[model samples]
Target: MLLAVTRQHEVAANWDAASLLADGSVSPEAGCRELPGCWGLAQPGPGPGDRGPCYAVPAAVGPQLPDGCKAPRLVCQLHFTSWPDFGVPFTPIGMLKFLKKVRTLNPAHAGPIVVHCSAGVGRTGTFIVIDAMMDMVHAEQKVDVFDFVSRIRNQRPQMVQTDMQYTFIYQALLEYYLYGDTELDVSSLEKHLQALHGPTAHFDKIGLEEEFRKLTNVRIMKENMRTGNLPANMKKARVIQIIPYDFNRVILSMKRGQEYTDYINASFIDGYRQKDYFIATQGPLAHTVEDFWRMVWEWKCHTIVMLTEVQEREQDKCYQYWPTEGSVTHGEITIEIKSDTLSEAISIRDFLVTFNQPLARPEEQTRVVRQFHFHGWPEIGIPAEGKGMIDLIAAVQKQQQQTGNHPITVHCSAGAGRTGTFIALSNILERVKAEGLLDVFQAVKSLRLQRPHMVQTL
Candidate 1:
């Protein structure tokens, strides 16, 4: 006999051989009818002497399997539980355990285990996310937790029941990693609470703080600009120029003229061929800053700049010998380097104007151009002495417009972080202007895909 199990909301079978089972009440003809509140569904398989297909139903309606239903011997089973409560807590884990138990209890058992919860979305989605995260972690892959959550939500609506529940899952993940146990702890619980309050509270506090500060500072500066209250000294420092030079030429010059034998084995420039042209200014090294600047001048470039950490031991000593202002000319190319107090900033506005003679012009008429720049500041923050890097970028962009040169070259120690931010911001600005819309999240996502480690902290 064929046996079908379902809930009260489902259609009842009309055939004579099929009997409805509500709460496991057997028909007088030896068939069964099961209803809601039934603890479980356990039935025998059809023998050779069995008559026909059997049908069963639960008294409850919606979509959830009965509490203790083992692998039932039936063509199909329909669960009808409400949307609010569908899958049991730890349902995925329980389902796996159930499968194992069923096999152990009856070694000869062989059938597909079918299950559903509510709309077959939330519970199913949770199962998928946990399994996927586990697989990624097991394989030693780096998975962006935010990206993973976003992807799941796009695919399955109501996948994450609430923000608190989502935070709980993430906390559970940390526990699973550190202790190899899914059990919770006070620390993890606290983190979950913080996350529920704000998404970034638990994951990216530093990043969020930095972003907030940048926006606030920019807003203040813009307001000052609107009121014509910006310092006149700021105008004097406004004109900036960025000079792009070929990296291959710099490498060759470093090898041939500087007699910098280190280039042969230097890991930083490995895979860098003579054909590649993108290059940025180098920071002070064991050699004197003048030596580096001299090479920059020899390259027939008109602009030079450097990024320095506030705490570097070399900062004080290097600034001592570097010229307050100097210029070099070769044919039509004139290069300059100006002495500006080095601090935590990745760009210097006053130095760029004083050093690059081409940028000395009125604010309204002066064009700004940016060269290689980065986004890092000191670990503490941007020092009082350093010029803001974003200001430098704005200056260079203005110079580029005036000079009809392309955008500035940007680079960092590894061509990431500060470098990536500069490029990303520029790209975002251009796209926003072109489309008249701003999509900050999409812009960041596109950038991160191109350079995985582009936004590392200083």
Candidate 2:
């Protein structure tokens, strides 16, 4: 059997390691289960799948060897799963990771590494340069990017397609030289966290504080074309620090009367298995409560996870936007609280949120939104309600499944610190259950891409 491993866009270390057969049959635990078009036929494995590109490991590609042939010829192919169909990856860390894995598994004298994409020019050439340059950097401790690209283009005119891809080659090298290898195995995660929490000298070279400081790069790298920062949208934000990253921010195009007015201080944070899984936003301000309801209506959100109370520290962190009784209207949207379950740590409220606009689609008329509000958070102290938090997450996930597959709305005072913790908790919990791996750092980093300053503590 041939060897292969698959990973998604994010750093999904929890995915099962699969052994691929000649006929594209994967181990029973393979993560993806979809019938892709380019795959020709729907096989149980991840191969010839064009709909969602995946990776193939170093294998001897050819007909079955003679009865007991020794030292068979080896042919290796590794597709860049993290690379986009259009552009290079957002960061070189993931690409560097893929390269490290390939080098480690590849047996000595494995012929050569062959990389290809659709056109076999842009990403293809870029990947070749990265792999080649890293070798030079390790042996000679020097790099000539322009010289290398020019040297490569001599044989193939299409090598190193765009300036961005060219720049990415350098970014990948720099990341490698600076951070050696940051990808941790799932088994070593707990030990790694314990080390990060202490002030030991082992972590002194690159401490937890330094790792947290990398959020600055994560923000600048994912450049924002922001409407949240605009004058018209600024007032809608309840917190000055919570500007939604425009890359995945939700748009409000279905407004009834307002034209050219689609703006909300909300960003789409990806979940363990889904993109745009959670809408991370600031608690609704007094004037923007209507806008908040509009977001719920537009996204057809099924769950709202409120991590903070309306009034905290004698301040109105969130405006009173829900009713305890029958129903209430907030501009173009109305909310009716059907049931309110109270507990020492969690207060569950079921809401029937509706848009007053006239539309043919009945599904858009109203949606059942289960709000999971936790009262365990202290204004200035750390939370100690571990069991309650897990229970709340269980209830929320149950509600998400009972309802349809819709994005979950999560918010706090600024939607970064507390909100991020809950989302990461849910994400990490779900990943641990499904993949048998735990990587809290990767989960936190994913949140920062959608909105800045997510999961600020260890």
Best by TM-score: 2
In order, what lDDT does every prediction score? 0.36, 0.70
1-458, model 2: which lDDT tens digit per residue? 22222233222223332432233222334333323442332123434421111243423334445686654343444555555434467766557656765686678756555554433455667777888888898889998888888888898876776777888899888877765665556688878877776774555645677666654566533347456667777767776666877777888875558753688888888776666789988888888788788888778898899989888889888887899799999987889999999877889898988777785377767877888899988888668758877888898889888887699999987888988998988887876665455555556766776688887665
What TM-score number comes out for model 2? 0.78
Q: How many clashes show up in model 1? A: 34
TM-score of each: 0.30, 0.78
Query: Residue 202, candidate 1: how far off, in angstroms?
Result: 8.8
Segments of candidate 1 deviating more than 4 angstroms = 1-197, 200-282, 288-322, 325-379, 382-390, 406-415, 438-452
